[model samples]
Each structure stands twice: as C-alpha cells, then as structure tokens.
Target: MPEPLTIMAVHAHPDDEAIGTGGILARYADEGVRTILVTCTGGELGEIADPSMATPETLGEVRERELRRACTILDVAHLELLGYRDSGMAGAEANQDPRSFAAADLDSAAGRLVELVRRHRPRVLVTYDDDGFYGHPDHIKANRITVRAFASAGDSSAYPDQGLEPWAPDKLYYTAISRSAMATFAERLSAHGINPPMSNEDGDVPPFGTPDELVTTTIDVGSAVERKRQSLWAHATQMGSNVFFARLPPPLFNELFGRESFQLVESRVATSLPEDDLLAGLRGVPGGQRHSPAR
Candidate 1:
C-alpha cells in the first residue's frame, strides 16, 4: 500500500469530530489514510443526555474518556486537544467564564493550531462552515482561529516560536449540512416517532447545505459504517440514544453517500463545483490522486 494521505480535522469539542466527519475518518483509515482529530476542548460543559451518565459531577471526565474511545473507534492516527474550555452554547453561562472557549485567547489558541500544521503537514484541512455548523460560539471561534492559523502558519513571520517551518494546506473545506439532508432526516424522524429539535423549525438552515453548486464528494464507507456507529457512540454524553444518527438508515445511507460531505472553501487545486470527490479537485497533484477513501 502507498503511504496514507495525511488529513487533519479540527473540531471545537470531542463529539464534534464524530458528529461532523466520523464516517469520513473511518473510510479514510480503512483506505490506509492517516487521519488525525484535533479537538480544541474536552467539552467539559456538554450536556449529558445519557441517563446512565447524567451525574453532573462525572460528566466532564466521562465525556473526555468517551472522546478518546471515539477516536480509537475512528482509527485516528493521532489525537491532540488544544485544552480550551467549552464555550457552551450561544448564551450559556459557561460562555461567561474567563477561561471558556468564547473567552479563549485567539492569538494563543491559534498558535497551538499553527504548531499542529507545522508538525503534521496535512494537505487538506477540515472544519465547520462559517456558521460554525449551527453558529455555536465555540464552533465559530474554532472556525475563525483555524482559518486565521491556516493563513498565517505558512508565513515565517507569524508565530515563529510555534516552530517556523510553514506547511500550507492546499485546501480548506467547510463540512456542510444540506437542505436535502434535512428533508431526508425529517422523514426518518417521523418514521421513528421522534420530534426534531425545536431550534431547527425556523428553516434557518446554513448556506453551505445547498451551495449554488456543490462539489459533491462521496465516500462509500459501506464497511466503515459500523466504525462510524462506534465512533458516534463514543460521544455517549451528547448522543445518548444516538437519535440524530438513528434518523439515517445505516449502511444504506453509507452505500448512498457514506460519511462525509464538504465544500471547497479555499483551494489552489480546483475551482469548479459538484466535485465527485474531495481529491477530485486536487487530482493533478500526485498525492492528490482521485481515490475514494471511504468503504
């Protein structure tokens, strides 16, 4: 087998990684691609919907352990946490904490990410869309800092102490949720007798979902769907009964579109939309050969 392509996913919290690209990660790993999960925080303030782990006292620690287990399930080649506090949701009290993610030192936070980029030298970088996948403050913050880091890390003048060797990621993607996906998911919810979250009623879906033209990158993680399930399960505190995923008819969904979808936000490779695969845009580059990394 050829050397696995290196990919890095930066997420605001432990569960975000699995929630956003668990399937993609599994698919890549199965194809011998080296995948790394960069979690910014332990998600110390996350909700514990799991009745079994509902105790307020143990939730943080439990969630942290769960994140590690999820990384294991995803076959992550490496896992690093930037050690910030969860900013909680939009207006939660946690956001008020001086050390909370919302209050995290942007320069310092970004410097940590710069170090990772310098070390891993990933060709592609992944993060939530500008809305931060739902405009969660922490998610937005992560997106902001990561984008800034991506732009600056490649410059020797920026944060030289973080290890000046610059490695510019060729492409940056925003993991998007589409209206079609929402419609499909709603149908699934009805079948399962589960009500959708109240916040979703406004139809205020983010723009990344249905791009004027989406470069569709499909990963057939048919075999890795089970791994995806375990990876999601690892975020037990957030997933609980796995309600969000239960909406999707597994393996079938995997066979259909698999675990990942991304829109090229910044790329030196390809400019056209509706890309069949992520690497499709980068096909001209030797390491960027068009190979479906998922199942």
Candidate 2:
C-alpha cells in the first residue's frame, strides 16, 4: 500500500513547535495529513514563566506533558523526542553541558533525526533557517541537524547500521516569521496604546522575522487558530502574563495568528511560486515523479 502523506517538523524545544509551525501542523492534521513533530531537547533549562506551574527541577517533566497536550490539540499523528537537554540561550552556561542539544555530536544528532525521517517517510520536512530564527544555541544546533538529516536520510549508505529503509522527503521548508507581519503587529500595538515587548525604543522592527520577499509560502490557518492558541496555552509554564500573545485581544490575536509563512529551501519536485498550500506539488504526485536527491 502507498504510504500516508506526512509532514515532519523538527524543533529545538517544546513550545517552539507551537510558535513557529503550530498553524501548519494543525491545518494539515485537520486535512487528514499525518503530522510528526520531532523535538530535539527536553527544555531542561527553560525559565518558569508561570511560577505556579513548575519548579526548575521538574520543568522538563512538565514540559513533556505540555508538549503531549499540544500535540493532541494540534491533532498530530506522532510526537518524537531526541532526548537531549536544552542548551539555554546563546552563550548561556547550559551550552557547555555535554548533554545539551547544542553540544551533541553532529553526526549522532543528525542520525537520530534521520532515523525518524526514514521511519516516518514524510513528504515534507520543516525546521528553522540557518540563523535558527532568533539564534538560540539549541535552535542553531537543531537547524544544523535538520539540514543534515534532510540531505542524508534518503541515501542508503548513510547511517546504514539503522536497518531502516531510506526515505527521502520531497520538500524541505523553513518556518518563518515575516518582517512585514511583525511591523504591522507593531503598528497595531501602537494604535492600541500598548507597548510591544522587546521592541526598540525608536519603533524599529525587532531583530527576528524574515523579509517578505524571502517567504515562499503563506498558509492561512484561520480555521485552525483555536487549536494553535490552545497549543500555546498548553505550554503554561512558558506562557506568562507579560507574553505579548496573551495580552492581545481576541480579534487582534486571531488576525495576527491567522497565517503562517515558510521559505522553501529545497524541493525534489517541481512547483510554482507564491504558494498558498504546503502540499501544492505533492498532492496526487506519484513517487516515481520526484527527482532523486541532488548533492
């Protein structure tokens, strides 16, 4: 029998999945796509944004449960963990930990992800860009491993000891936060007489978010916004009162979170530009039609 259509999203932490790719995850799952989330770390050093939720020692355990709840809310078909520790923000002490995702051996981490890719046999793969979105150490590391897995998973010679069938995904995408969207959010915040978090004093755009032209696909998740929001709330230990997401009114929040964007970094199949759906070229496609992996 033909394999099920699948999407595998690799992330650095529990909540990272919600903020970046929750829309796509929920939207695709609703459409009967098999959504697989591979989180690389246990989020061991995450701060307790909700002090009443979890203590430092139990944060990891709490986060695992939270992530499970989020997966359920998003209707994800599978949730996998790479079992590495969180390497706290760039340059933080946690980066030195041998168990942290940032300190993990490249081939080893990529091997772990590659195993999942082969097992899941996804049609699409997603992760952060080279800059790792906002440059967190674990995020940067996650990007590296994901890129490596995307390139190596299909090669029978790669990680041969695994004994799993080689499976190459048809496309690879980088989840992106658009600069235009951020700027517009800033404008909306200003018009509402509320100060935007982490905004520069002079109203310059924040350091994160991709330029509009760089974004290759924008998926409107208006129908799945509730699931995404619930997924966010599931990570209660990470969602404190000061969070901009929680502070916004319902309508504004819905409007801002209604769509998600991605950059198509690699594709083995032919596709047109300005895509509105992630499965544009893959739907009804024959496996024989996909191009072989190119080095």
Candidate 3:
C-alpha cells in the first residue's frame, strides 16, 4: 500500500487551529492523512469569552483542555506545543516578557519547530502569512518561526544537533481570508443593519484580509463544516455563543467558511492556481509521499 499523505499546521494558540484550519484538518484526516498540529503558545493571556469560566488563573489549563478536545474533534494525529508563553495582543505588557512567544529568540523558536518537521516529515505545512493573518504579536512571531523552520528543516547543515534527519516539505501554504469572502460578509452585515468587522466608518478596507488574486488554493470543506463548528465550540472559554462566527446562521456560516482559502507560499510540485485540494500535484512527485509513524 502507498504511504498516507501527511500535513502539519503550525498555529499560534489553542483556538487558532479551529478558527483557521479546522475544516481542512478534519477533511484530510477523514481522507486518511496524518494530520499534525503544532501550537506555539499556551494562550495564557487570552480572554475568557465565557463569563462563567472567567477564572484568569486557570484559563491556561482550561484552554489546553479545550484544545485537546478540539484536536480530537478534528481528528488530529499528533499534537505538540513549543511551550512558549502567549504574547498578548500587540502593545500589551506580555509582549515585553522574555518567556512570551513574541519575545523569544527567532532562531531558537524556529529550531523547536524544525525538530517536529523532521519527525513528522509532512508533505505540506500550513502556517500564517507574513502579516500573521490579523497581525497579533504572537501570530506574527509564529509565522516568523514557522517560515524559518520550513527553510531550515530542509537544510542538513542547519540544526544538525537536533538528532533528526532533515526533511523538506513539498509545499508551504498560508491560511488566508480572502477579500471576496470579506466583501460578501460585509454586504450581509450591511443588509442586516450591522456594522461589518472589515470596514471603518470611512468605508476603507482593513488590513485583515488577503487579496482574492493572491489565493492559490480553495479547499471545499463543506462536508466538514459541522465538525469544524464543533471544534470551534470546544474552545468555549475563548469564543462566546453570540460572537460573529457563532451568530451566523448555519447556511451562511457554511457558505462563508465551507471553502477555506490559502496562498501557496512555496511549492516543489507542479500545480495550477485555484486548487481544490491542498495535496494537488503532489501524489506523483518523487519523495513527496509519507507514511504514518509506527504505533
């Protein structure tokens, strides 16, 4: 039998996996891919959206437990944490803390991710763009380290002492929220007399979305939308029931999120744009396949 394909998604915090890549992860796992999640921080500084669970002292532990449940819902094959502290929103005091992920040394943080890349040997890696989606400090730091690790993990001379052989992923993708999607949501919000999140009073586009032209892949995860929703709901402390995502009717929610977008930052395989599958053109490439590690 051919080896199963593998995909690794590197995220900044616990809830991030659900918000951005939940659909893809659940769909690929269902299709027999070895899905791995590498979370950069403990999300210690995240706000508790649930009023009843607002114990700041235990938020980290609660969020960790929520993440585990979410991983299970998404059928993630492996979960790893880089063990860094959460650097709160940009300009927050946590950003000044040495232990926070945003404050960590770039080389050191990337080295930790390199170890996991070598061990998993995934054919694809999914991470944030240079802007880190919404530009949160930890998100930007996660993107920095992940980009570095993607390049360094393939170079044998780099981090040679990590005890794992160098393994290069066939493709690197940035999770994207496309401008088209944002526009559609904006229209819906305006129709309902609600202020959209993507615009200011001046009617100018915000920095939160990627240009539609930049999106190279759009995976149809319609079938996995329910699972994705369940995964997001698992992080109860981070998301409230009435938030934007939760408030959207099921049909509209699926319409917006059912098709996830990504920018193919780098690829070693031959593939065309607007791809419907993340593993497009990779199945037949030499050295592009991977097997699940033995139990």
lDDT per prediction?
Answer: 0.72, 0.87, 0.85
What's the candidate order when arranged by decreasing lDDT? 2, 3, 1
Q: Mind giving the per-residue lDDT tens digits that candidate 3 earns over 70-96?
A: 999999999998989999988999999
Candidate 2 clashes: the total is: 0
Best of the two (1, 2) by lDDT: 2
Q: lDDT score, residue 33, model 3?
A: 88
In model 2, what lDDT does residue 90 have? 88
Root-mean-square deviation per candidate: 5.7, 1.7, 4.2
Model 2 lDDT, residue 248, Cα: 76
Task: Name the best candidate (by lDDT).
Answer: 2
Runs in model 1 with CA error above 4 Å?
1-4, 50-54, 198-216, 241-259, 281-295
Name model 3 segments beyond 4 Å from true. Answer: 1-3, 192-194, 198-207, 288-295
Q: How far is candidate 3 from the true structure (C-alpha RMSD, Å)?
A: 4.2
What lDDT would candidate 1 get against the real structure? 0.72
TM-score of each model, in listed order: 0.84, 0.95, 0.92
Q: Model 1, residue 19: what's the lDDT?
A: 54
TM-score, model 2 to reference? 0.95
